[model samples]
Target: MIGVLIVLCSLHTGFAVTHTGKGCVTGSTGVRDLPEFVAVLMLDEETGAYFDSKTRELQIRLEWALNKVNDSQKYIHYFNVLISSAIPDLMNALQFAMSLYGHSGGIHTLQIMLGCEVSEDRKAGEFMKFGYDAEDFISLDISTLAWIAHSPQAGIICADWNNHIETAQFWKGILENECFALLKKLVEYDREILERKVPPEVSLLRRDPSSPVTCLATGFFPEGIVVSWQKDGEDLHEDVELLETLSNEDGTFQTRSRLTVSPADVKEHNYTCVVDHSSLEKNIIKPVTEEEIKTNQDPENSLPVGIIIAVVLAVLLVAIAAFAC
Candidate 1:
């Protein structure tokens, strides 16, 4: 996995305006013995894109965003080139770094992170920017070759190729004009898709006659769902265990709540599983009863028993025909 941290801040009308963007590139060997890349780009934690080499698809906001673009083929081509061009260099750098560290052969990761932070006040302006490969500490400055930090070679690298003044000025322009411009465009494009919500598929299950009653909610999007157990129209807090929300492969979420009840209590009180989510206009309430439990536990028994009687009658008719013949 690749991790990048970026921070940009500006002073406008006596308030600080901050913008951040992160880009990640990950590569792994696949079944075809070829390297595969997964590239993720994020802007201010609101808009993001993921390109998967194995699927050859680019997904944005849990949907295929490439199809929505005007020139989808061109967009795909650009992303493919951007990701594929970086794989070999990154892998080679990682292998070299691993050798230096005395590590051999298994899956290794090389990460490159680029960040820029600028903060300004009335009297002074400050800017910080860095790009580095995490594995070997080979880093980049505005006008310097990749050099190991804190090593003897670092002094030579600084003296020979340092262009701190020009590099800093260029980065300032890029951060304000290019990076922030892309962020604004992405946020505007993805506004509607990001706001879309999906309702939860609520279900109640009792796997065995003696097992605890489980209330399951799956396929819910946006992650702000509440599942609770209620008895006789009142919420029950005791003897209830709620599991963590787990992510589905399709970008939805699932969670379950377990309620422990004695046989006497089950007979005496009515139980229900209640779900509340933003997607639902009204709360969903699914009542749990002894009959529902029995049905869930033994659903196959509900098939028609008359089919057996019909088979027996058919067999007798055949036997009588045989005897007459």
Candidate 2:
């Protein structure tokens, strides 16, 4: 089985840092036997960017203002370096951590989150954690690497490592001296752009444009948008499937809401797709028309019509042949 390594970074108006990297190794049988691990360098509510190791492609494009900054390139270069250097250690740590769990091969996840939150008062709180699935194996706070929390038995091993004083000290130093340093600089540099909010361009689409239509609301921003199908004035919940929100290349988001409707319902009912987002002062409503529905119906659904026509032709041919005979 192939492993996936994902790296993410985001900076928000409050200067919060959310940097996380995760790697998962799977067994040959497509089972996850090796531990999955996530390492974070920073947390926040802003749109984040993803870097695919295999493709080496950045999913989100940099804002124009960000592109104009000289340090932006330096920042991106540093991010690349951090991910490259940390991934190996994270993978090794995952393998070692998995071994300690007494399992050679199975699906397990290890996550590390490194974060810094600065209050309006200029006081900063830094946080870091190492966890397996939902269980926190170790946690630390502040620049001194003070032990704030840990798992019951896992705390023993964590404490031992802290006593040696390298791991915790390293993260504390990096978070305070390096990560926060960069965060402050980047936040100040991109303050205007970071504070600016761009509303998404909402588009309603049909999967088949016909009966049993799947409605898609795409190109929304800030990751907060409501998409639903409605009949008349009431909302629809039955036969509705809402897919997960997907991130666009521009850091906006897209989601799909599917509705199943019959031909009779299309003719009698007024169906609409309603979208609400922070960017919009009022909800955007797109009505579904009968013509649109009929125009978009699946071509496969016309198979019965074709079959009927063929049968009629065959019967006419048989009658003609009999008369001539």
lDDT of each: 0.49, 0.48
lDDT of 2 by residue, 32-123 (tens): 44223222221233322333234432222345434544666566565555444444544555566666777577565555544554444242
Candidate 1: regions farther than 4 A off: 1-22, 27-36, 42-64, 99-107, 113-176, 197-199, 231-241, 246-252, 260-264, 279-283, 290-325
True lDDT of residue 93, candidate 2: 58
Candidate 1 lDDT, 1-325, residue by residue in tens: 2122111111111222333344444444322543344445443333245555566554454243344466756665665665555555545544554555566766554434332322221112222221223233334443333233544433443343244444334544554454445444543555444346789987777776577888878877666789998999898999999987655555567788888887678888998999998889999898888655532541121110000001111222221222122
Which residue pairs show backbone clashes in model 1?
none
Q: Who wins the lDDT comparison?
A: 1
Task: Provide the RMSD of all predictions against the true structure, rounded to 1 decimal.
Answer: 20.6, 19.8
Best by TM-score: 2
